[model samples]
Target chain A: MLSIRNLKVTVAGKQVLNGLNLDVKAGEVHAIMGPNGSGKSTLAQVLAGRDGYEVTAGTVTYQDRDLLALAPEERAREGVFLAFQYPVEIPGVNNVYLLKAGLNAIRKHRGEAEVDAFEFLTLVREKMQLMQMNESFLNRAVNEGFSGGEKKRNEILQMAILEPTLALLDETDSGLDIDALRVVSNGVNSLRRADRAIVMVTHYQRLLDYIQPDHVHVLTGGRIVMSGDKSLALELEKRGYDWVKEDSAAA
Target chain B: MSLSAINQPAAALDHYRALFASRNVPDDALGKLRRASLERFLAGGFPTQRDEAWKYTSLRRVESRRFAPADAMPIGADESQWIADAGHRLVLVNGRYMPTLSTPAPQPPGVTILTLAQWASHSPTQVADFLARHDHAAPHATPPTANGAFEHLNGAFSDDGVVIDIAPNVQFEQPIYLVHQWCMPASARSAGSHMANPRIIVRAGAHSECSIITHWVGDETAESLTNAWLTFDLGVGARVSHLNLQEEPSRSFHIETTRLQLATNAHFGKHDFALGSALGRSGTLVTLGGPGANVSLNGLFAPTGTQHLDTYVHIDHAAAHTTSQQDFRGIAAGRGRGIFNGKVVVQPGAQKIDARQSNRNLLLSNTAEIDSRPELEIYAHDVKCSHGATTGQLDPVSLFYLRSRGLGESEARALLIRAFAQSMLSTVQVGAVREWLEARVQRRFDLSAGEHS
Candidate 1:
C-alpha cells in the first residue's frame, strides 16, 4: 500500500532523513523504532506532506499514486492520516466540527454524498464511545486545555473517524499514562482491517506490547539499519539503541 | 498642533450654521441649549489627528463633502423591510418621524413613546422639566459628553426622534424598536450630499425595566451622513438594555454618540454592532453614578473594502461598589481600517469599584489595519481595574488545521471570524436581537453560501 525509495529529506539546510527506505503491503502493521534525532518523526512528517521539508531526492508512492506531489490537505483527502506527536490546541474550532469536516471531505473526494448533521452526529458519537470520550468533548474547542493524554486520545478518535487507508502514528504513547495508553491502544487496535496499513514511529517498545506489529525496523542516522520481526523491539528495549548504533557503524 | 489650523473647516461650519438659521427654533431654554452646543462645535471644529482621541481616524472625507440638511423624502414600501419584524416600532425618515411607517403597539399604562417634535409642542413644560433636570452642567456624577463635534452637531441640527419614558416601577414586557432611515433620492445626490441629525432621549424610571433596539439604515448608493445622539438615563434600581445596530451603506457616513447614566443600584447594558458605512464612528460614554450601579458595554465591528470604522468608549466608575466592563472586537478585511479606544476611570473615594476593558482585533488582509488603545485611570485606592488590547491575524496553525479538514479556505476563515465576533453577539440577551445580528454577520462575511458548515 505504501513505498518509499531513498527518501533523502532536508529541513533548514540539515539532512533529517538521508536515504531512508521503507515498504509496506496491505493488511500489515509496521513499527519504526529509533532514538532521538534518528528521523523517526521526519519520516512521518514527510509522508504527511508538511511544508518546510525539502525533498532533496525521494519518491513516496501510496496506492499507485505519487503521494509526495499532493498538498497536505489533498493527501488527507486521499486517505492519508497523520496522528501528530503533539496535537495542536485550537481555541475556537470545535472538536466534532473538525472531524465532520474531515470525514465529509474524504467522502466527497471519493464521489460520495456529504453526510448530514444527524447522520454525522451518530457516526461521531459511536466513534467517541469507541475512544471512551465524553459527549462534552465534542462541544469543547479542539484540544484546547486538554491534558497530554486527552490530546493523544483525540488524535486516535480522529484516526478512527477518518479511517484512512494509510495511518502514520508518531509517538502516540509518549505523554499517555498506563490507563490512557490502554484506551488509546484499544482505539488503534479496533481500526485494524485487512485492507488498511499503519506505520507507528516510537522510541520505546511499550506501545508494541499492545498493538503488536508485523515488522519492526530500527532507524539510525536517518536510514533503516535493521529489519526484523516483533522480537527485534524487545531486543532493542533490553539493549538500547547503542548496540544498533555500533552495528550500523561497523557495517 | 496649532489650534487654528485644526479648527479650520469654514465651508462645513457655514453649511451647518446656515441650516440652524433656517430652522424655526424657539428662543427658549431648549433653543439656548442648541445655540450653546453650536458654539461648542464651532470652538472645536472637526476633530483631527492632532487630537489624542481622534488620532487614528480622520474626518477629512466628511469635511470635504458639502452636505445639506436632509429633506422629508418619501418612504417606499420596500424601505419598511428594515422594521418588518419589529413588533412595536417607531420609524423615522430623514430624522423626521414617519407615523405612517410606524407600527407602535398599544402602550402599557405608564409607558410613553412620542417623537421629540410632538413632545416639544404638546408637552412643552414636561420637556423643559426633563431637559432642565438632567442638564449637562448640573452636579450629576455622569461624565460630560465625550464626542464634542458630533454631539454638538446633532444638537444644533437635531430635527426629531422618539422619546421613550417608563414610569416608576413600570416594567415593559415588549421592547421599543427605533428604526432611523436616511436615504437621498438620485436627484438629491446631484444637488449635494444630504445629512440628518436625529436625537433620541430615553428615561427609565426607578425600579422599572425595559429594552430598546435602535437601528440605523440608509440607501446603498446614497452619499449621505447621519449624525445621531442618544441619551439614556436610568433611575434608581432600574435596568435597561440598549442595542445599537449601524448598517448604513458603504457610501454613507455615520456618527453616533450615546450618553448613558445609571443611578443607585441601576444596571445598564449596551451592545453596539456596526458593519457598514464608508466612514463610521461610534462614541459611547457610560457613567455609574450611585452605589451598586453596573454597566456593561460590548461592541463588534467588521469592515471590508475601503471602509473605516472607529469606536470610542469611556466608562466612569463614580460611585462605590459600582462595576463596569467593556469588550470590543474588530475584524478588518480588504483595505478596511478599524480603530478602538476604550477608557475606564475609577473616581476618587469610589472604593470597591471593579472595571475591566479589552479590545481584540483581527487583521484579515495585508492592507487591512487596526489601532486599539485601552486606557485605565484609577484614583481610588481600593479598586480592581484591568485593560488590554490584542491585534493580529488568525493563527496559522489553526488556519492550516481547518483547511486540512476540508473546509474551503474562505469557509474556514468565515468560521473563525464568526466565532471571534460571536463572543460579543452572544451577549445580547434578546433572542430576536441575536438572530437579527447573526443574519447580518453572515451577510457581511459572505457566509450565506452554506458557509456555516
Candidate 2:
C-alpha cells in the first residue's frame, strides 16, 4: 500500500534521511525502531510533507500517487496522517473545529458529502470512545494546555476519526505513561484492517509489545539496516544499535 | 504653530470672546460651563514631547500649524445622512445640541441632556458642580494642560458640547449613538487651519447601565481638525460601555482625549477603532477610583499611505483590588505608520490590583511602520501586572498552511488577520454591537471575501 524508495531528506544542509527505503502492504503494521538522532522522525516528516525539510532525492508512492508532489495539507487529504511528536498549539482554534475542518477537507477531496455539525458530532463521539477521550476535549483549544498523555491520546483520537489509509505515528509513545501507551496502542490495534497500513516510529520496544507489528525495521544512520519480525525490536532493545551497525557493516 | 489673525483683536483673547461676541453659545448653564472650561483650557495650552506621556506623539504637528479657536457659524444645512447607520442618535452640530434631530427616548427623572449653552443659559441646579468635577486639567498631568494646543483648542470652543446625566438604577437597553459630524462648507474654507473642540460628558448613576457610541465623521477629505474630549463618570455598580469610532476622512486631522472614572463595584469597557485622519492622535486616562472596579480598553487601527495614527492609554489603579485589562492591536499597510503607548500606573497601596496590557502590531508592507510601548508602572507591593508589545509580519507557515487548505492567497491572508482580531471582538457583551463590530473590523482589514466567509 506504501513504497518509499531511496528517500533522502536534509534540513539546513544536514542530511537527516539517507537513502531510506521501506514498504508496507495493506493490513500490515511496520515498526521502525531507531535510537535518538537516527532519522526515524525525519522519515515520518518527509513522508508527511512537513516544511523545512529538503527532499534531496526521493520517490514516495502511495497507492500509485506521487506523494512528494502534494502539499502537507493535500497529503493529509489524500489519506496521509502524521501524528506529530509535539502538536502545535493553535490558540483560539477549538479542537472540534480543527477536527471538523480536517475531516471535511479530506471528504471534499474524495467527492464525499460534507458532514454537518450535528452529524459530525455524533461520528466524533463514537470515535472518542476508542481513545477514551472525554467529550469535553472538543471544547478546548487545539492541544493548548493539554498534558502530555492527553496530547498523545488526542493524536490517537485523530487517527481513529481520520481513519487514514497510511498513518505515520512519529514518536507518539515517547511521552506517554505505560497506561496511556496501552490505551493508545489498543486504539491503533482496533484500527488495523485489510486496507489500512500504519508505520510506527519508536525509540523503545515497549510500544511494539502492545501493538505487535508484522515487520520490524532497524534504522541507523538514516537507512534501514536490518529487517525482521516483531522480534527485531526486542533484539535491538536487548543488544542496542552498535550490533545493528556492526551487522550492517559485515553485510 | 500658525496662529490665525484674530478678527476681534484683544477682545477675542478674553476667554468667552469667541462664544459671547458671536452669540454661537445659547442656553445659560451650559454657556457658563463652557466659559469656565476655557479658563481651565488656558491654564494648560499645548503639551510637547518633553512631557513623559506625550513623548512618542509629539505635539509638533499642532505646534507647527497656527490654529485659531473657532467661532461657531450657524450651519444652515442639516446632516441627517451622517447618522444613517445608527438606530437612535443625537446630533450635535458645531458642539451645540440640536434637539430637533435627536431621537426621543425616556430619560431618567433627574438625568438631563443639555447643551453646554443651554446649561449656561438656564443655570441648572447641579450643572456647576458636575461640570467642574471633570475639568480636563489634571493637577499632576505631564506638560500640564496649558502647553497642549489640542486641549486648549477644545477648551476655548467648549460652549457647545453636550452633557448627559443618568439617574440611579436606570438602564438604557439600546446604545445611544452620538454622531458628532462637523463640517464647514467649501465656501467657509480659510487660509489658516482651525479646530472645533467637541466635548461629551456621560454620568451614570449607581446600578445604571448605558452604552454610548460616539462616532466622529467628517467631510470627504475635509481640510479641518477636530480636538474632541469625552469624560465618563461611572457611579457605584454602574456599567458603562463606550465605543469611539474615529472614521474621519483622510484629509482631516484628529486629536482626542477620552477620560473615565470608575466608582466602587462599577465596570467600564471602552474600545477605540481609528480608521481615519491624515495625522490622528488619541489619548485615554482611566482612573480606577474604588475597590472592585473593572475596566477593559481595546483599540484597533490600520493606517495606509502617509497616515499617522498614535494612541496613548493610561490606567490608574488608585484603590485596592481594582482590575483592568487593556489590549490594542494595529496593522499598518503601505506607507502608513501607527504608534501605541500604554502604561498601567499602580499607585502605592493599590494592592491586589490585576492589570494586564499588550499591544501587537502587524506591518504588512516594507514601508509601513509601527511603534508600540507597553509600560508597567508598579508602585504597589502586592499586585499582578503584565505589559507586552510585539510587532511583526504574518507567520509564513500559518499563511502557507491556510493556503494549502484551499484558500486563495487573499482569502488565506484575510482569514489569518480576522483570526488575529477575533479574540478582541469576542469580548463584546452586546450581541448587535458585536455583530456590527465584527463587520467593521472586516471592513477595516479590507478582507474582500467577507460575504463568502
Candidate 3:
C-alpha cells in the first residue's frame, strides 16, 4: 500500500531525512522508533505533504501512484491522513464543522453524494462515544483550550471519521495519559481492517502493548538502520538506540 | 504638486460659501448657528497628513469634488437589502425623513419618536436650543481636528434625521431600526455631485433601556456623499446598545461621527460594521461621565479593491469606577487600505478605572495595507489600562491544517478569514442582525478568496 525509496528530505536548508527506505502492504501496521532529532516526525510530515520540506532525492509511491506529485489536499482526498503531533488550536472553527467539511470534500472527490446530516450526526455521536469526547466539544472551537489528552482523542476521532486508506500517526502518544492512551489505542484498533494501513512513529515502546505492530524499524542518522518483528521494539526500549547506531556503523 | 493644488482649499471654502448662500436659510438662531459652524469649517479647511490624527488617511479625494446639497427626490428604489421584520422601521432617503415609507405603528406611552424636520417645524427655537446645548466640545478633552471639520460640515448642512426620546424607567421592548438609503436625483449628473448630512439624536432617560440598529445603504450606481452624525445621551443607570452597519455603494463616500455620553451607572455598547464605500471614515467618541459607567465598542472593517476605510475611536474615563473595552478588526484585500486609531484616557482623580483596547488587522494581497495604533493615556494611579495592536496575514500553520483536512486552498483561506472575523460577529446579540452580517461577511471573503486563487 505504501513505498518509499531513498527518500532524502531537507527543511530550511538542512537535511533531516537522508537515504531512507520503507515499504508496507495492506492489512499491516508498522512502528518507526527513534531517539530525539532522529527524523521520525520529519518522515511523517514529509509524507503528509507539508510545506518547507524539500525532497532532494527519491520517490514515495502509494497505491501504485506517485504520491509526492500531489498537493496536500489532493493527497488527503486520495485517502492519505496525517494525525499531527501537535493538533493546531483553531479558535473560531467549530470542531464538528471541520469534520463534516472534510468528510464531504473527500466524498465529493470520490464521486459520492454528500453525507446526510442526520446520518452524519449519528455516525459522529457513535464515534464520539468510542473516543469518550464530551458532546460540548462538537460546538466548541477546534482544539482551542483543549487539554493535551482531549486534543489527542480529537485527532483519533477525526481519523475514525475520515477512515483514510493510509494513516500516519506522529507522536500520537506523546502527551496522553494512561486512560487517554487506552482510549486512543482502542479507537485505532477498531479501525484496523484488511484494506487499511497505519504507520505509527513514537519514541517509547509503551504504545506497542495496546496496539501491536507487525513490524518495527529503528531510525538513526536519517536512515532505517534495522528492521525486525515486535520483539525488536522491546529490545530497543530496554537497551536504547546507540547500539543500533553502532551495529549499523559496523555493517 | 501643481499650482491648482495650492488653491484647492480656498476653492473648497468658496464652494461651501456659495452653497450656504444658495440655501437662503432664515436668519433665526438655528440659521446663525449653522453660519457659525460653516465659518469654523472654513477656518479649519480639510485636514491634511500634517495633523497627527489624520496621518494615515487623506481627504484629498473628498476635497477635490464640489458636492451640491442632496435633494429629497422620490425615485423607485430597491428595498430588498433592508432588514426584514426589523421593528418600527424609519426610512430616510437622501437624509430627509420619508414618513410614507416609515411604519405608522403608534409609539407606546413614555416613548417618543419624531423626525428632526417635524420637531423643528413645530418649535424651531426649542430645537435650536437643544442643538446649542449639546453641540459644544467636552471640557478637558482633546479638540477634534479632522473629525471636527466633518462635524461642522454636517452641522452646516444638516436637514432631517430621527430624534428618539425614552422617558425615565421606560423599557422599549422592540428595537428601533433606522435605515438610511440613497437615490440619485434625475439632475444629479448635471449637478456634479450631491451630499447628505443626517443627524440622529437619542436620549435614554434614567433607568430606561433600548436598542437601536442603524443601517446605511444606497444604490450601487449612486456616486453621492453621506455625512452623518449620531449622538446618544444616556441618563443614570440607563442601558443602550447601538449597532451601525455601513453598506454604501463602491462609488460613494461616507463619513460618520458618533458621540456617546453615559451617566452614573449607565451602560453603553456599540457594534460597528464597515463593509462598503470607496472612501469611508467612522469616528466614535465615548465619554463615561458619572461613576460606575461602563462602555464597550466592537467593530470590524473590511476593504477590498481600491477602497479605503478608516476608524477612529476615542474613549474617556472621566469618573470613578468606570470601565471600557474596545475591540476592532480590519481586513484589507486587493489594493485596499485600512486604518485603526484607538485612544483611551483615564482622567486625573478617576480612580478604579479599567480600560482595554485591542486592534488586529489582516492583509491578503501584496499591495494591501493596514495601519493599527492603540494608544493609552493613563493619569490615575489606581487604574488598570492596557492596549495592544497587531497587523499580519493569515497563519500558515492554520492554513495547512485546514487544507490537510481535504479543504481546497481557497476554501481553507476563506474559512480561516471567517474564523478571524467571528470574534467580532459574535458580539452582536441580535439574531437577525448577526445572521445578516455573517452572510455578508462570508460572501465577501469567499469572493475575494476565489479572485486571489
TM-scores of all predicted structures: 0.94, 0.81, 0.98
List CA RMSD, all candidates.
3.0, 5.5, 1.4
Leading candidate by DockQ? 3
When summed lDDT is taken over every stretch of 10 residues in candidate 2 chain A, the lowest stretch is A86-95
lDDT of 2 at B41: 48
Query: For each of the candidates, what fraction of the native contacts does it recover?
Result: 0.42, 0.08, 0.75
Write the number of the candidate with greater lDDT, choosing between 1 and 2.
1
- Candidate 1 residues B11-40, lDDT tens each? 678777777788877898679877877887
* Interface root-mean-square deviation (Å) of every model: 2.1, 3.7, 0.5
Name the lDDT value of residue A151 in candidate 2. Answer: 88
Clashes within 3 Å, all models in order: 0, 31, 0
Indicate which candidate wins on lDDT: 3
Give the per-residue lDDT of model 2 (tens digit) for B155-231. Answer: 55654678777888998767777887656566556645656677788999999988888877766624667788888
Among the candidates, what TM-score does chain A have in each?
Answer: 0.99, 0.97, 0.99
Docking class of 2: incorrect
